[model samples]
Target: MIVDSHCHLNYGSMTEDMDGVMQRAREAGVGTMLAINARLSEYDEVLAIANAHDNVWCTVGSHPHEAEKEPGITAEQLIELAKPEKVVGIGESGLDYFYEHAPRDLQKANFLAHIAASRETGLPLVVHARDADEDTAVIMKEEMDRGAYPAVIHCFTASRALAEACLDMGCYISISGIVTFKSATDLQETVKIIPRDRLLIETDAPYLAPVPKRGKPNEPSYVKYTAEFLSHLLDWDYDDLARTTTDNFFTLFSKTRRP
Candidate 1:
């Protein structure tokens, strides 16, 4: 069975037809899903979705895009909110220089708070890194020196140097459908060298649907396409790729139970 390690089930299209979405995911061999919370304000909706589905789990924390909204959000607040059994990870948070929706300083401060919560709670930090690899790497390394915390770089599309740096720090790299694009040759090559045990796959659904599903609204079930592409790219059996990524998901998000 496959696991869509990151998705936004609370968003419009999927939320309106959650039952249908869950059914489709099951039919697609998706055994479990991690419903990511991109904003603290939406935690209830995200958590409710997870609470309603036994195979679904959620995370707590703001995205870099929403950093300015919650710049003062502290690790203590995140730790308190994450006490819920359904909340399995922290922060789809990190630097997103590509969009720059939030100020860089605010984003960094917010990212560090999420890191602290992850360290304290021992939950994997679901990181969203884009075009800020240097600062992201430096912050991660600095924090790792303070105390070790589990993390996964979700939807990674940075340089090979960043991938290698993250891997060196024992962090897992999650590839999205972006790796299947023709223009992503660099990312594709980087993905090939990622250790199997440290590799993961996500749809980041409602966004980045893989080829064939490209340009359409993405969903958790579409993660299979990303997995299928990787099986070919990495030259592993399809089932084996599914199993490896699913195992890696549970390993990093240890708070979630295998369904």
Candidate 2:
């Protein structure tokens, strides 16, 4: 079975037909999903979804876009919020220079807070980095100097340099449907170099749906297309790719049990 390591179940059309979304996912062989949290204010909603679905788990923290609004969010606060059994990770956080929705300083501060919470709790940090790889790498390296923590770079589309940095830091890299695009040659090349054991896959649903489903709203079921694309890209069997990525998911998010 495949695992959608990152998604927002509380967002978009999926929320309108929760049962259909999950049923389709099951039909497509998706057995597990992580409902990511983007803001502390929405943590309860995110947790509720995870709580309601035995196969679904969640994280606790703010996204870089919501950094300014949750300016005072602390490592302690994230740690406290993560007490729920269903809250299996800490973040969807990091730098997002591409959008710059929040000030860089504020984003960095919030990102560090998340790192600290991850460090303290041993929950994996669901890092969201875009066009800010250098700072993301530096900050993570600096934080690692203090203490080690598990992490995964979700929806990764960064440069080879950043990929190497994250892999060197012992963090997992999650590939999204972006790699299936013909225009994603660079990303595809990068994927070829990622060690199988360190690789993970996500749909980032209600967002980057893979080709064929490109124009339609994305959902967990569509993650199969990504697995199929990667299987051909990596010259591995589809079943192997699915099992490998699913195993990697549970390894990083150790707090979660396979459904």
Candidate 3:
């Protein structure tokens, strides 16, 4: 059973014709997904999608991009929202220096709040890191020193140093469709050494579609290509690769029940 460990199902393209999108995923053998929410204001809609679909689960928190606008976000608030059984993770939250969508200090504050929620709730932190690998790794390490919490560097496209830092902290790394790009050979190389237990795959759909599907909108179904590509890169059988990642997802997001 394959799982799309992270995606934005509420994104326009995905929500517009969600049934067909989900049907395609079923047809493609993608059995479950974690529909990530990047803003607290959109929690109801995001949670609605999960409520409407048995195999879908969700998280609640603010993205760095929304950090500046969501000044009231608190670890206690996140813990309260996470009381629902379906709310299995604390964030699609973390730093994003590439866009600087939110002020860096505010982003850091938001990221730390989510980390606190993760530590308090025992739910994994669904991290979304971009060009700020150095600072992101520093914050994650410092927080771990304060107290340990589970986290996954979702849609990872950072440097090898960042990857090693995550692995050393016992955090998981989720590879996305970007690894399929010809220019992403370095990322592919980094993906090579990730221990099987520490590795997972995602499409980051309605966004970065893999090759062949490049330039087209992505969906959970598109995770098939990423998984197939990783199987080739890691020399694992397709079924075994899927099973390994499925187990990894279940292990890390233990709050999510396996179908």
Candidate 4:
């Protein structure tokens, strides 16, 4: 079975028909999903979705775009909020230089808060980095120096050097449907080098649909296409790719093993 390691099912696009969305994911052989929270204000809604689905889990962290608003958020606050049984991870956080919607400084501060929460909770940090490889790497490395924490570079689209650095830091790399894009040659090359044990796959749904499904709203069910593509790219069978990534997901997000 496949697991969509990152997605936003509580977001408007998917929430409008959440039951159908989840049904479709199960039909597509997706056994589990992580409903990522990008804003603290929507924490209840995100948690509600997870509560209703045995196979769905949630996170507690603000996205980089919401950094300014969540500037004072503390690691203790996240830890308190994350005490719920269904919340399994710490973030969809990190820098997004491609869309500097929040001040760089605020983003950095929020990122560190999430990192600290992850270190405290022993939950994997779901990072969303884009066009800010240098600073992202620097901050992650600096934080690692302070003490290491589990993390995964979600929907990665950074320099190969950054990918290598993340791997060196014992972080996992999650590839999204972006890998199936015709223009993703460089990303494909990067995907090729990722060790099977350290690789993950996501849909980042409501966005970045894979080829054949591109130019349309994405959903967790469509992760199969991305996985299939990665299988072909890696010259492994689809089932093998699915099993490896699924295992990688469980290995990293160990809390999901709870009943």
lDDT by candidate, in order shown = 0.93, 0.95, 0.93, 0.92
Q: What TM-score against the true fold does each predicted structure earn?
A: 0.99, 0.99, 0.98, 0.98
On lDDT, the candidate that comes out on top is 2
**Residue 151 error, candidate 1, Å:** 0.4
Off by over 4 Å in 2: none
- What's the best-to-worst order under TM-score? 2, 1, 3, 4
User: Candidate 4 overall Cα lDDT vs. reference?
Assistant: 0.92
Error of 1 at 230 (Å): 0.3
Where does model 4 exceed 4 Å of error?
none
Scored against the true structure, residue 240 in model 4 reaches a CA lDDT of 85
Clashes of each: 0, 0, 0, 0
What lDDT, from 0 to 1, does candidate 2 have?
0.95
TM-score of 1: 0.99
- Which wins on TM-score, candidate 3 or candidate 4? 3
- C-alpha lDDT of residue 190 in model 2: 95
lDDT of 3: 0.93
lDDT of 1: 0.93
Badly placed stretches (over 4 Å) of model 3 are none
